[model samples]
Target: MQKTHCIIPFEKNRNFTGRESELTQLEEMLFAGDQTTKVAVFGLGGVGKTSLVIELVHRIRKNHENCSVLWIPAINLESLHQAYLDVARQFGIRGWEEDSADVKRLVQEFLSRESAGQWLVVFDNADDINMWVGTPTEQGTKRLIDYFPRSKLGCIVFTTRDRKTAVTLAQKNVVEVREMSEDVATIMLQNCLIDPDLVNNKTDTSSLLKELIYLPLAIVQASAYINANRIPFSDYLSLLADQEEDVIDLLSEEFEDDGRYQNVKNPVATTWLISFEQIRQRDPLAAEYLSFMACIDSKDIPRSLLPRGQSRKKEMEAIGTLDAYSFVTRRLANDALDLHRLVHLSTRNWLNLRNEWDDRANTALHRVEDMFPRPKHENRALWMSYQIHAQCVLTSTKDREKESKEWYSLASRIGECCLSTGKYQESESWIRQTLKLKEEVLGKTHPETLVTMNNLALVLDRQGKYAEAETINRQGLHWL
Candidate 1:
């Protein structure tokens, strides 16, 4: 499955592949029936998270006709608030204004009642962690979630990219997800093609498909282009292999404009970039957070690792900015905190393409290299904060893909510097992290993605984890 799996009929033709296990898990959690279940399914973008949930919601609606299934993409606090009000409207709450606290109270009251039985609410993409930082939208969806009735009849599901945020909200209920299977990817490609029989050409098609790592998003996009252009599957493969710009161009087609999702562009990458631009315009602090994220770990960004140099007011404002944009999310698990991988990836790619980022990529990398692990015996809280900064810095730029290789060379020099200074762990981590970003944004099939992949993989192999090293080797080969 590629990015094109997001297309409706195209994806449906393949009969909805992957995520069966996740669906079953959700069903069990929602149907267990004793306590009000607060479950969260989280993972990277394009890993079939939303699709699986959509399928689950459809099944629940069809089977349990009495229950009201509400789907809300809490893209931001305002969006989340709107979704809450929409739910209220569903219950025939007339005269309910979106900003009215009275409407919110009523929503809480209704859900609290025993009669609101077997209802399920999905807070999809509620990954923005900024929601909890300050003021915290006391009157809107956050309040709604906090106030939602705790009853066996009520079930709440949140899909997010931030594991920390999900865990914080649902605790042990968080379920992490991954990409689709190879078999499913092949089926999806075949079904999406104009002539499905062409999919059987095991030589070039299979080879190209494997290069995409069988990611649902990439596969779907590739399939749509191949079918739409009436080109041999091998030619499409050759295009992806030809140049970084070509792959980016190929992924940016308008394939998923199937009515309901008119706003979301095709290739998944561009659609995600709009959200990135939104964050930048609506919230500079959040945009900065995203820029910081581009140069970081790209996963496992702990809240405690964030920079608190800002005064409490500034901190709150920054957190609020991110929450309002739905760019950074936190999962509250009694006390634990986590960030989403998808948010990180989207932000990194967004920054990578911005000609402006090239100017600061080196400085950002140096900042991260300077602060990792913190000074002396760090507490878990401080460790988390440092890691988050490190991740943000790592993700903020792509020295490898710049018009000049100076940034990449600078990164290499820094890594070697760290290594010579007996900070081999930091050196290796920085190199590997930078390499991964280059591969994703600069093109895994391009020299930059491939070279960094090789450098990082070899570094990893030297430190053991040969299996991990081998995986990187194969990833680089896809570029070849």
Candidate 2:
């Protein structure tokens, strides 16, 4: 029996979250005695697909001594070919010794044989479908996916975010990875903590887990923040509960993950930005819609809000382009859309880095405000859905008053509706939050901040807090 030939770049992530079922399912597919099994695990970036594959390989290595495991990356041809060279060096391929022939093909030919034994080869992050298959659209010389060694004695697994790529590479044998379960996510958060006792408060730990929406990468990142800053989960949650900048700053802060490449400094943003750039290059229209979606609430995004072309056909095609990569998901109930919150944040950060956030943010703010009616009795259904999306944009805008007047107006209207609906406390909370932000951004003397202060005092008076209301009024008058 030969030892495994697996030579992955990084050590296994000790903090791996729950993917037991996924690992079992994938393992079964690999060992099903199909030497040419082309199985794929596909999902959004940082969704733990790679971790699942790595765990499967680990199990196979430990339990099956006769099996040979080869892990290669398909991030690009250069990386793939370098991996091939490593394989050649590892296996002592004949022609590769003197570098007499093309080592890549030699390595492929060497592995694509019965004598290769039962092997499980993993192509992690096989993102570019055409890059593998060498389609006409691909720049320079195209290479068919057959470049990888294929043998009846070997099995192949691909991890990709592109659903179409998964289909192309694996046919019907594909598993769609999803976010971690709440319990598993909590466990991961606990594991990543430098001091487990720091999370002694189960309630706070559980609350932070839910706030992260049970995503493994985010859970890990939050834990990294906690460990590095020596802060509690509750404090980090407060930042997340605050402005978008807080969330952005928290996520944009980089930490090491064994499963990630070394150059990938920021896990959440850098990982997704790769796909975003690809989509932008492939179809600018899809890119535009993605940026637009990033600006709104990830849930219940209406088709009417998208950038539609001359015909509905064009609109569906644009949406399909995004769907192909799983960047956004469609909600059948309301015929709306939703996306991963991290994806939403990463997209905005992408724009902010490129200096395009203001353009896209302002566009979405104006459209949501003008298209959706104020929250009122006539059409509460439409207004409710529309207002949710509008609020998403409003909250992301910083204190730059001139750049966000439309958003401010919309927020004011929504605040009024909250008061009329006997949501006095809710209205007061909203007014106070905005007033604080405006004061920070526009200063107390700024006209908008004064108006916000007046509204906050009114809401306080309405709530029968006359003394507090008087103090707020006096502050506004003094600022004047």
Candidate 3:
């Protein structure tokens, strides 16, 4: 038997925890069929795709004595070219020392040969589709996909943040890396902490993991922070839950990891920013949708709440793009979309960094205002479904936005909805806000102002404040 030669760039992560099922499934797939195998492991940016793949590589090296391995960081065109050049040099491919030699082609040809033996090539961070498959107009350009070696004894693996890229490369043979289970996450958190006693308080440790959304990179980063600052898990959770900005700030803090690319930002908040920029450059509508989503609630987003694109098809396509990136997922019960909570916070920070928050917030406000239904009995189901999102938009509104007519109009509708549903106190609060805005913009005697005043009176009556309600009623009558 020929000896296996491995060229894995990173050492196996000693703190790697969980992922038993994924590792098993990958091993099964690699050895399943007689033909060459291709697999793509895809997920959200911080979900630990690379770490999972690294673990898989080490396992394969341990178990399969004849299986050689190579690792390529296919992050971009330049990196891909450089990795191929290194491969060519390592393989001692003919004429590789010459600048004129097609090093990528040389590496491809060498790997395709049966003399290369059973091998696996891992394309880590292969998120960009344009690099693998060139644009339609770039027919003359050589694509990275064209250079993939073909051999029955070889396998290919890709780790990416985009499912579309995964599908393009591996078809049905794809594994989606989702957030870790609580048990798995807890174990990983314990392994990562310098002081294992920090995890002794299981509740605080669990809360911290949940706040980080059970993402592996986030868990690692949080552990690093806690270790460095000598803070308890409870304190970290407090910072995370204090406010959106605090959460963003925590995720934005850079940390060092030996397993990660040195040049890449380690923070979860900024890591996905690369994918956001790519989406913006490739599909503007998808980017617009992301920005709009960031300004509202992260969960249970109704389809109608989003602004229409050129057509329904275009809108679905835009949504599809976001879905492909694992930033948003369709809920099983009602098909309503839910953005990942952490992605939600990070995207808002991204917009704030670019000074685009106000515009996007206004856009979200207008869309919800336009789609919010009246609180009629027949529209109860529809309005109820929209109620939470409407509240989210209102909560996201700034002080200046509170003065806008659009803001009050939505508030009035929500207030009426609350009234119809017997939420007397909540209804009173919304009505009060709406009435103040109306009174300021349209004066006390304006018909709209009177309508708002009447709504307030009705809410007060519901709450058993009959005297105050009657006083307002009499004042409205006097105005009339």
Worst 10 residues of 1 by lDDT: 1-10
Number of the top candidate by lDDT? 3
Report how far residue 118 has shifted in candidate 2, in Å.
Answer: 1.6
270-297, model 1: which lDDT tens digit per residue? Answer: 7567556655665566566567655666
lDDT of 1 at 5: 8
- In model 3, the clashing pairs are none
- Please state the error at residue 3 of candidate 2 in Å: 8.0
What is the full ranking by lDDT, best candidate first? 3, 2, 1
lDDT of 2 by residue, 235-354 (tens): 888988887777777777788777777755645656788899888877688888988888888877888877656677767777887887777888988888887677887898899888
Which stretches in model 3 have alpha-carbon errors above 4 Å? Answer: 1-4, 31-34, 135-141
lDDT of 3 at 474: 98
Which prediction has the highest TM-score against the true structure? 3
lDDT of 3 by residue, 358-452 (tens): 88898899999988877889878889988998988888878899989889999999999999999999999999999989989889999999999
